[model samples]
Target: MAGSRTKGSDTLRAAQMYYLQDLTMDAIARELRVSRSTVSRLLSTARETGLVQVQIRSPMDSAPELERAIRAKYRVDVHVVPVADSVNEVEVMERVCLQAARTIGPLVDSNAIIGVAWGATISAVSRHLTRKITHGSVIVQLNGAGNTQTTGITYASEIMRRFGNAYGARVEQFPVPAFFDQAETKKLMWRERSVLRILGLQERMTMAIFGVGSVDADVPSHVYSGGYLDEVDIDSLAASAVVGDVATVFFRADGSDAGIVLNERSSGPELALLRGVRRRICVVSGESKLNGLRGALAAGLATDLILDEATARSLVESDGAAEDAVGGFLPLDTASGR
Candidate 1:
């Protein structure tokens, strides 16, 4: 009887190795010092005993739950993009762009001022926009398109042209750096009547769209890898405990503005200004951007969020972790303007 029991245990072990460990029957047989037939029999027994119960977790399965959690937490419209586990960075960006375009296309109308931020993700969205042009609609660049290394006007122009062509609306470009070298320059530019006119249109924008920037995002974030920030600037952002950004403005993990020097130079609207917009849509992706996404929410920058299922899950799971790191819930004052 003892010998019989030993043989049974060997059979179970062989089955576990073959079925659960995903080894070939022959490999299991060799490892267990048994025949292939024995390995096969063990695998059958393992299945019978429910030891090898296989489940294929669908990436789509988690999207509903994620959307629920995100909406409940942030009180905003959330669209969770279903992505397979093996999706690459470019594919992820494409999905995000597609979804954003679908969502935004119907929302636009004549006499609407639509503000756009320049970045790879937003550029992708612009490419996918198929809406027909209507009268009195205008697409405006939100910030200066220039960076430290080069002028990003080409990128900005491409987005503007696409939107203008699709909507048959006028395109208004900011025609400046992503950030001014000095606050005084920004102040002086704001005083220029022509600049002020464009800025006024931006301020009155009916709808605004942008992408979040993660400090360690897998998909290259425009602000981090876009040659907008130098080594010293990156180092300073890290030292300031920055997690993520919306429109090139860094925010802390708790959704508070970092008040970094770079912000002084940034041309994007302040968080408060973003919140004041009738509709502020933010598109982001990747598990790496989880923290940044959270910060954007905590800061109340996103009235609507478009993200992938994986990222949405990570954000929900990170609540406790963020509270410990940041020491409080982010204030809900939409007018605070971090």
Candidate 2:
């Protein structure tokens, strides 16, 4: 037992010197009064015993070519999470969400107000967040979660609680239906002080976190599957040629929401208001969301995008194909100014 303990101690020490202290094997060997080969063995043992961990992170996460292509074409920052082609859509979301949670920490600071859109992707992301304490920071829900079937407070609150716990910040929930029965009702509600307070918070947001909603996704978007939209509403969206949504405001394939009709009653902030945010981080995964993602990009909904490698590759390929067919890539409004 004593001999094993001594060997473990030696391995741990060698690993600290080499990895943490940046000491070369020669220096470690000399300091320990042992041979370079022995030092190498100790380092190897450290790794084998789980005393040392090495992570290789590329400038673009893992897909530099794809990220660069997307960035150049979309005029937005891109991070492509490395995921195997054969992985299932659920697994893809898990990986992308994990990476997004890690990436989000650095973009926030003291007194930052963060707008969080609750959806399947964002919910998954909330589960993986690493604690990042910030003073006077607030995490506010970007859209209402209530529908005819449920209040949605429980589901949305759980997601918000995770973020609040992670950041040690306060949580603010939006109390309203995902969409009102009438546009006039929505307009009236907006005039209320309580409702206006949430909207006011949204305007002051420094960062906005969201995910594109697609009805066709393998894992259906929460808004589509959560009873937020009825058959009549779904049919309306279809007739209007809606492709996807960000924060419950649906948009067409061309990124135009003008004729969607449903926009007037949406409880979510307007695209213009979302653009006013300094940093908008959009997270997506799975090829099923490809068209929706494209619509979101064309709408200039995101300033920074985090997506899985497979989705990123598909995005690049489809865009290139569209550019070929159109003779050029179409210019976007880029409301957030990239």
In model 2, pairs of residues that clash are none
What TM-score would candidate 1 get against the native? 0.77
Cα deviation of 254, candidate 1, in Å: 1.6
Clash totals in order: 3, 0
Each model's TM-score?
0.77, 0.83
Kindly list the per-residue Cα lDDT of model 2 for residues 1-338, writing each as its tens digit. 32445665778788989998999999988887778999989987665433553446767564888989999988889888888788888988998988888778767787989999999999999998866567999999999999899999999999999999988889999979889999999999999999888889999999999999999999999999998998899999999999999999998777778877899999998887887888999999989999899888888888999999888999999988988998887766542123
What is each predicted model's overall lDDT from 0 to 1?
A: 0.79, 0.87
lDDT of 1 by residue, 1-338 (tens): 32345654776677666656878888877777777887777767554433444434576488778888778778889988888779997898898777777777667788999888878788888888765447898888888879768888887899889988888889999888898888899889889988888889988989889998886888878777878888888898888898877877778877777467778888888777878899889988788888788778878887889888778878877764656788854445532343
For candidate 1, the lDDT comes to 0.79
Top of the candidates by lDDT: 2
Report the Cα RMSD per candidate.
17.0, 7.0
Regions of model 2 farther than 4 Å from truth:
1-62, 334-338
Cα error, residue 36 of model 1, in Å, equals 60
